[model samples]
Target chain A: MTPPTDPFTAFAPALAGPPRLEPTDVSYVLEDTSLGRMLLAVRDDGRVLTTAFAPDAAHEQHWLERVAQRVSPRVLRHPRPTDAVRRALEDFLAGRARQVAVEPDLALLSDFQRLVLTGLAASVGYGRRTTYAALAQHLGRPRAARAVGTALAGNPLCVTLPCHRVLPAAGGVGGYAGGPAAKEALLALEARSAG
Target chain B: MSLPPFQQLVDDHWRDVARLAHGLAGPVHGDDVAQQAWTQALAAYPRLTHARNLRSWLLTITHRCAMDHHRTRGRTTAHEDPASLAQAPVEPPPQAPDDVLWQRVRALPERQRQAVVLRFVGDLDHRAVAAALATSPGMSRRLVSDALATLRLELTDPEDPR
Candidate 1:
């Protein structure tokens, strides 16, 4: 039988689920950065769960949903990002930080994607760049460069994993999760830092 | 295969689970029960072998959560004293001024209330209700029937006992 169309029953959908349901160990900070305002979720263990461009609540919600779909559904809120990830992001944007050392939640990635991201993030030097084909070749999947792009496109850890350094083999800057403009800005920042 | 996205699962079933939780945990503690249920459900989701009885699976988890909520909060359960049915609901009297009906519903035995809620409010059939409450289908049917008969007799004539 259909639920009764009573006032209380009608309001059922609007009632938020109770507290204690959300995973509290993972918290997110949405902050303004040189690239754009971004939402970043970090676990208590300090792993960066995901980073996505968010200029407003709608954008934050969009990225949060994707995070839930791909990484964790237990997202919660924190007043600030983890100190290390925060400092690294801030310093990098201001041209003072050397590395954005965030452990991407491998749970958010597939085996191949995890390996590809790990390889690129660890090996790609700052201020320099490499084609997806070259990076794939370096990782010993020489012919899997297109597949590497597919993996990078779904990268959860964004700039902290330094996926912006992976351009297309055609030489023009390739697609980025944070958009082409943010990608270019990051590369420029790294170049100026490198010199 | 991976489970459906957690957000999608919550969107689809929270209401049903909330109603069931509200019935088990009552108003004051129902929200807490619902939240804990979701937490446990999400953690156990990946291990769920199949989705054949997702509603019952969730309700079963919610049932345990509600029970735990009551225990941790030191609330009374019908198991404590079957005779204490007098501790019935006290809210919504002005709204459903004839809401003496809900109060009496609350006055039923604990198992009976659960059965009534699953049958009428949850709209679950005997088998699903049984799976939800971890009882046999036949017993679940009997519990609902007994509760309905009791309600019909006692509610129609508050002074009479059958």
Candidate 2:
């Protein structure tokens, strides 16, 4: 048996199973807004992580899996953690406020997408619309208008980041994850509030 | 009315559930039993509508997990070698000083033990205990009374003939 010794058996006891991952508690609340049913998710520290529109059963499942993979598997349905953002959204949708006072946790977004979105938010004020080309220019990427549009199309923060305010340079309402009707409605609401 | 956040439920009743687990599942398997209950609770949380008596509901889940732990232990004891089983990790030091008292409670009949744990360790009233045990309020009261009598006799007379 000394001649048939295997090295791996000696370490088998130490190599039992995968290490346990700690649970990160992410809280969320779903509410009906002027646009449609909106699902807002926040980190344990109360920073807004996602603001998706009309999340159907499939969309809800996909969102859960995404958060579980990117964050932790302990995503919980909690209203208090998301209450402040929900109130701000309610006020903005009701035309009582021009903008939601939400600090977005863009940890889930790519660096380039974060750069483009933050640049657009900083340059464009409430009730203001900007062309994708203009936002790219503002970000110092003058020729990246198409790239900027693609980033905005995949915007995870949605209303909280004011992605609705960005439109096509050629004069159409442009594509919105919330749908074309939602984009037009949001623009109209912002126009009324700004006026 | 909308149910309160699942996190809130976990926060408020975690200690109670852990205590009940220790009482029901015993020290060795208590932590595992509590964790299992919370895992089950999280999966079924979204469909919960009412917020009334959430503690009782949680205790019910914990009881179910404790039951499952015992059932699994029963089957494993037959196949598992005694020497290897002795090498299993020891549970953390118990918070309660009365180890013997808890052992006696665990020795009680199943229903009586559950009733006592839910009533004392869980800090739930008789009705809540009833809800957790899926019995009537009257039966829960009788079970607790009977368990207390047995514990009292055993504690006073160390040589109780059973």
Candidate 3:
């Protein structure tokens, strides 16, 4: 295809008129997490649509297309995937053992929550496990394990933050916002890849 | 108050959300922005007892959501190559009659292209376009004028009177 000298012209038709809104039977879920509230609209075909935050209460046409994107199938198929969760999945699936270097998309998160999520992202590793108690201790708050768990449960970016990897030191699976089944499935996937 | 009213709102504004989003980023990002707007609007519906215009409300939410997405993406160290902007798919290719004019419009600056889309394609008046872009009416007018001038220069020669 010959590149247009003016890139905007190629899409001018779509731009010329107000864009049309099409209706689809997609089921959407709203999740309020430690980071921020997110909208997860799922099409029947499993395309996942998510935004960083809620719109302001006053504005008409509050939603804009610039914020939306279709997540790749690999990320969407994972049992627990947030915008942050998907990045970890991408790295691990691409054969990276330690995704500590991966960063969470914190657009919706407050600074403290972003810091907690970042710490969780670094502390948790693939196929390995850490207890919420251990995590609290790691962050220098031995008594705040429950708070740490609450933070983990409220994490908007699920797998990317590796909340699933944080198990109970006593051998029970911990709570996951995407549900414990999702947590188990991710652990299994990591194990399979490891072996 | 009931589910159907909420459902009706979704049906009415879904595309507008997507379109506004597309203008902000492109189609791929538009879908995500629309989805987020729907979820946020629905959750806050109970608090909105006096909402006179649902469409505008939804569009506002969509724009905010898109901005949040931009802000979050900005914080990450990742950089998008300028070349990638060229790779975004064009939805409707122009037919022979308007193809040349369409090409000229596309060659305009990003701000001008956005102004044209808001005014012409979005069917938004100057005020609505201004609201969507968060610009003043005068500025919006200037954007449209600049875009039109560029298009006229490219599409029509001074010597030619069609």
Candidate 4:
């Protein structure tokens, strides 16, 4: 009797019958943007042999191995974004104007800052605009728009909460975490969809 | 205290996750339940430091998600025929060798069957089972015991205690 040819034949073992695992030919790219480092791993067939994370080779290699063990070493075709960012991107692409879940990885913020970010996350909707002052008012401190802007300027997950959707009441594109070009692109994308 | 490595935790406790899923939702939907549970757990990983028991915490989340899925499905399935419920054949009871005993076990109320499966299949202690079912431990224990007694009576032969 011949065995299955693929090595990833044990991917999902808990299912009723034996599930055949097909080796996916894909490349996974991990970006540690805050640290200005990126790791790219190309899995030929099912085996991951070539892995690289620039700027800090040793630390990147260690982090790659650690992350690999928790998730499948075989990366999905595209770069993985934070869950919140991914959800926001999907909603934007699908022509929906809402985000269901916020990304949990908003590092470098105080607890109060996070609460403000959460309010901002909930405030911005698809195809609509809210001012920073409007957001501060919603948080029960109308005087805190500048503080709210500071919190949003440091937002780690860019598109998920549609932070780019916030603008000045005088009708200016407010500061964007991803910079003005990215914000312009996002707004244009949303505008094209709405049109 | 520094926590154990995430991979090590997942490797050590993945079986418990599967069993909990199976108990909450039978085999057909268990894998989806487990997958969604893992996703939710990973999303909640940043707050894991506050959790006392990782295993129980994971199980609680999985159980809640499974129950939510079941309720959503029940609402969606309300209009379906009750007779179609028997689409899936029941696996023969492991200890109940007699057909009569199997029939009696099948006839037990859904809550009693769920409590029994949580006890046996999930290997969850009585208290954990009660927590999973959102009921009192005494009630959970009574449900299982009463279920077993009913099976025993239906399957008993007058000739032997064995």
Candidate 5:
């Protein structure tokens, strides 16, 4: 074989010589729900990272940057969703736990956001609903409805925070960070749970 | 709010990390060393306080992993010889240009070879190379220059100056 012109280019084969890192710290599991395909990432200790609506793998790839920024960059995929996480997600999605509140790990959240999240977690139940204005007022920041929206949008733990239960004050269901479709599904699911 | 580019970390650094491992432990244990380094690094990636160069951080991990492998082997499963690495199962064949080049890299003197590999293969800067090799930046630069000069004579790159 002729010696390569450039050493760096020539030595590229060694790139394949070593085993790669496969992180198992965080695991991803995809489930097809009534709304669409939902991709959920979880931690070893059963912390629900995010439940995004991913109609397909391409759709899921859109969240790579956000997922890394919000949850972790080293997340790994489990062969299947863990039983505990699956059960919790099923209960939440099915609206069986609507009257109850949820508390997911909020390590990535800010103090002010945590305060707002804690308030929402305490006040809103699965079957109940609140408006962003009401939530801001509840936190004594009546003029901060937009800020409340920003906080909810950045909520590290989505469904667990029940951000879906919050809506626009004027009457229509509000925007959900997961997607508008997911919000509609959750609201519809809750309406049934309420009855 | 500005976090490091986490998603691209492995995809960008894996090859460089592997090259460092192979350089340190030779072909046989190279894969193992790289694996351990990634596992360890990925486990601690979340709380990473800061790093000027992510590659250096990865090399630091790879270097430690190689050391651990050597420590565990104690003298039994010693690192492979450069001449013998041609028989490594991972690559195409010894006749392949890339394989030939790597074998030559393995033949370089210890410190010079490490400096060269860390500089080019691991894509580390002078300071990072020095940090990984536990030497001064000046020493790392000198070693790389000397090694590259030798490689130039042997491999004969027209683009590179002697």
Candidate 6:
């Protein structure tokens, strides 16, 4: 066979190369659930990073940017890292599994948010519900109920962290990142399973 | 076993991939070939169900990407500077430090060159080389031996009888 006259000319198209990506970049996967599309993002160390209920393209973009800002901006979509947590969340939402035994990386949250969310995860169980004021009191911040509400509002781990289990001290289910309908559905599912 | 993060794969094998790229596509195009392979790997990562050897999987992608680079370059005008193309290796030298031996290996027929590079530069076993080259393990072993034998003859002193 004739050796090519030159080696440089044939390979210039890819010479520009693909965009740079780090080996420790964050990765995510999107799963369709009854509530909406859920995005499960994971850190490079293989811990659960953040979960979001993306109702639309814009919602998905917003969560991606949020992760990009808080974590490494080198996020890419790959399912292997988040597969276990994704499966657990799926099972939990479908009432097939009672618990998601995965740990969310709390380092992404503010100190106050981390404190409240950690308290909630430890104190709450499936089919159980807590009032925002009750959770604040549990955290020894009886006067910080509204602050707890704010912290929970920005709950990055969402269902995995059991933020849906927090209701209003008033007589109704409070807001959820996945919307009120999803909140109610999750509560009802847990109630049926628990019963 | 579970697949680790894609980033982990990149971190683990990037240097090997770059070396293989240089061996296959020459120094000038090696980085480009490696980057293109990784970009394609990232795009297709989710669809891959089982990868018994991730290194082999990655090397296969790099080989195909480099080959694609060669084919595409065949169609384009050969206007790039030859002096630059033949410049000193951009990547660090492989285990075999003899530059003349490596150049001769590069000039070998494509299959022999690929088999030898996968065996040495990519540090893949015979089975892994077979997987990357899409050939039988026996064939990969034969190709590697043939390339090595030729290199031994070419590099040894022609007048000195061993």
Best candidate (score: DockQ): 5
Put down candidate 3 lDDT per residue, A113-180, tens digits, no spaces: 56566777776666777887888888877898877777766554555566778888778686665556
Residue by residue across B1-162, what tens digits does model 6's lDDT show? 234456557657877777678767776667878989888887776567775787888888998999899898772211244565555344333333344555677677889988987887777889988987888999999999998788777766657635
| Local error of candidate 3 at residue A78 (angstroms) | 20
- Angstrom error of the Cα, residue A184, model 5: value is 1.7
**Model 5 lDDT per residue over B21-65, tens place:** 876776666777888888788778877876556778989889878
Candidate rank order under lDDT = 6, 2, 1, 5, 4, 3
Per-candidate TM equals: 0.67, 0.53, 0.37, 0.40, 0.71, 0.53
Q: Can you list the residue pairs that collide in candidate 6?
A: A10-B73
Kindly indicate the candidate among 1 and 6 with the higher lDDT: 6
lDDT of 4 by residue, A1-195 (tens): 111112112212244421112223334445543323434333433233222224464644454444344333433334432333334345654557544233243333457667776787676656677788988899998898898788777553455545777788887686664456666776777777767
- iRMS (Å) per candidate: 5.4, 15.3, 12.8, 11.2, 3.9, 9.8
Better of 3 and 4 by lDDT: 4
Q: How should the candidates be ordered by TM-score, best one leading?
A: 5, 1, 2, 6, 4, 3
Q: Can you tell me which runs of candidate 1 are displaced by over 4 Å? A: A1-17, A21-44, A52-87, A94-96, A105-119, A133-148, A169-171, A192-195, B4-15, B35-47, B65-94, B145-162
Candidate 4, B60-139: lDDT as tens digits: 77878887887877722211334433443343112223223323534667788767656655566789879988999999
Please state the Cα-based DockQ of model 5 relative to the true two-chain complex: 0.31
User: DockQ of candidates 1 onward, in order?
Assistant: 0.18, 0.04, 0.06, 0.02, 0.31, 0.04
Question: Runs in model 4 with CA error above 4 Å?
Answer: A1-195, B1-5, B49-51, B75-107, B155-161
Query: What value of lDDT does candidate 3 attain over all alpha carbons?
Result: 0.55
lDDT of each: 0.71, 0.73, 0.55, 0.56, 0.70, 0.75
Model 4 complex DockQ against the native: 0.02
User: Which is the better candidate, 3 or 5, if ranked by lDDT?
Assistant: 5
Top candidate (TM-score) = 5
In model 1, what are the clashing residue pairs, if there are any?
B96-B99
Residue A46 CA displacement from its true place in model 6, Å = 1.5
In model 3, where do residues sit more than 4 Å from their true spots?
A: A1-103, B1-11, B14-52, B56-162
